[model samples]
Target: MPTPGFPPSTLDSEGTPIWISDLAGGDPNHVLHVVRGIEAEDALEALGAKPGLIRSCELPDSKPDEWTSLPCAALGVEPGGSAALLAGRVGEWTFVYDDSGFTYDDAVTKALSADGRTAATSVYTINGDASLTYAVDGEQVEWVNFDDLELDEGFAGMPAELRAAFEAAGNVETEDFEPGEADGDILMRAACALAGLALTLDDVRRVPLLVVPFG
Candidate 1:
């Protein structure tokens, strides 16, 4: 059975599991808007981004998708296998992509290319081992062990009561905690609570996938 606080998963017509983010509602400070169809340059232009302000980086070969013919020059630290490209920053939002792999569909890409205003809300992915890899802005943060996360000083910003609850939840010493299961559910709640994030069970399952945070 699905956890109480988590959202439910849906299956696409092809029987592929589709998981939505638990953080999709209300107005969020951080969001993942997949700009489809638009080439790297076109997407930036549509966003009103100035030519001189754009930035790019060369990611390591191990990374998912590294685009060799990126429209902009390489800037910032080498993203290694974490991210292939950080196109540029537009106002409060940043544009990013992995030339190594495709994250969006053809229709979404077409819409984004045709009109700069079109974008799809994105959700991060969870790995098979229940580890979460995500990015803030364009920087990558990964290998987060949801079950055994240390709720020490890093979580000082959380409420006292919430912190205490997470501490009381104890840590999972097991190698992995399967998402959607009871153990995974507990860890997911604790992690979200510490990060001051609200997510559903279905959202938790989509971990090790793709997630965009909102402050």
Candidate 2:
């Protein structure tokens, strides 16, 4: 059985998984985007690569520009996997592929090359409507919305302890507390991770996901 409130895993009329590329092809307005998971290859295949990929690393112990910063989480990375793959739209959104057995610097370089852009270390994070929006066959998906998708998926892998934390947080309710007040768990978890706090799976589940904030 499926959860009643959550978005359904997309299916076709015949109950087949819909390939985003096929969906996007029929109506250019339907852009299928993925930020986390083993779905990047599929997303790229569907949308095709655009020019000028940018990448950056998140710095622990400091809050970088919110809209233009990476998650500086200590994801328990091991040797030979010191850096995360901070790829995607450079400043706007980054998908941290940690323990990827790759260097962050090198991964960023390759990503930039894929779009035929000369990689530069000290470039201004792309801004403006042009920078925030991505198109597939001319359909637009805003990066702001895309970040929510990534954050949600990221928590999907969080340990059970964190989930309990969330359940606990969700319990503290007051007549004065707005519906949005329930999201403190999501903020705490994501902020902890973004600030390089050691994360347990328990922590992951407890994090309040700020979905509507981005939307």
Candidate 3:
């Protein structure tokens, strides 16, 4: 059996995979906090979600019109519903949760735009092993395991000065640095600075990199 907060491979009676969140032990009351922005909050409230009564099963379904209110109708409970809501929004970035399989690394794997072009350089761990994944248009483009590579290798494309700052911050080291040790927020800011893009740390953390072409 999968532990709490982990995505489950077991299919519901309808054959849909189950995804869950750790917020409030998958309780709706606590997990709803993951939803941000007054717009998103209003949508949730209009959908009949209330504090302390929201359950993992009562979230709106992921429909084709995900960004619109169509998906906000608290129609029925579905497996992974809570996770879907939690990953719904954090301002402009739309979080994408991995529901393809059951794994302890069940987390927001991609944070992209509504148009599906830009994406965050995602860092996550599985069973204590850390890795980095770069994606575009919802497709993974690169994946690197921390153990097989140095921390600096991932940021080689970054500008020299920004890279140096990261190194000075102890985020990039040839021999001693390990993956999952560096602060993701700091690294994201460094990347943004190198690109000359003005963005908040929350934006950096949500979607670290912007995909070139809108996809």
Query: Against the true structure, whose TM-score is highest?
Result: 3
- Worst 10-residue lDDT window, candidate 3: 23-32
Clashes of each: 23, 15, 2
Better of 1 and 3 by TM-score: 3
**Candidate 1 residue runs with Cα over 4 Å from true position:** 1-33, 46-48, 55-74, 77-95, 98-118, 123-215
What lDDT does model 2 reach? Answer: 0.24
TM-score of each: 0.24, 0.21, 0.32
The TM-score measured for candidate 2 stands at 0.21
lDDT score for candidate 1 against the true structure: 0.32
Off by over 4 Å in 3: 1-85, 96-116, 121-126, 152-154, 158-215
- Residue-level lDDT tens digits of model 1 in 1-215: 22232222332221112211121111211212333233455554443445555444332222122322121112322222322223432332333332222233333334343433323222223331232223223333222454554444443544453344345433332345343222433333333323323333243333322111101
Q: Which candidate do you rate higher for lDDT, 1 or 2? A: 1
lDDT of 2 by residue, 1-215 (tens): 12111122322322212221111112111111212222322222222222132222322332232311122232223322222222222222222222121222323333422432222111111120111122222222212221242332333543443333233222222464454333212222221222232333222224321110010
Report the lDDT of model 2 for residue 196.
Answer: 30
Candidate 2 to native Cα RMSD, angstroms: 18.0
Clashes of 1: 23
Backbone clashes in model 3 = 2
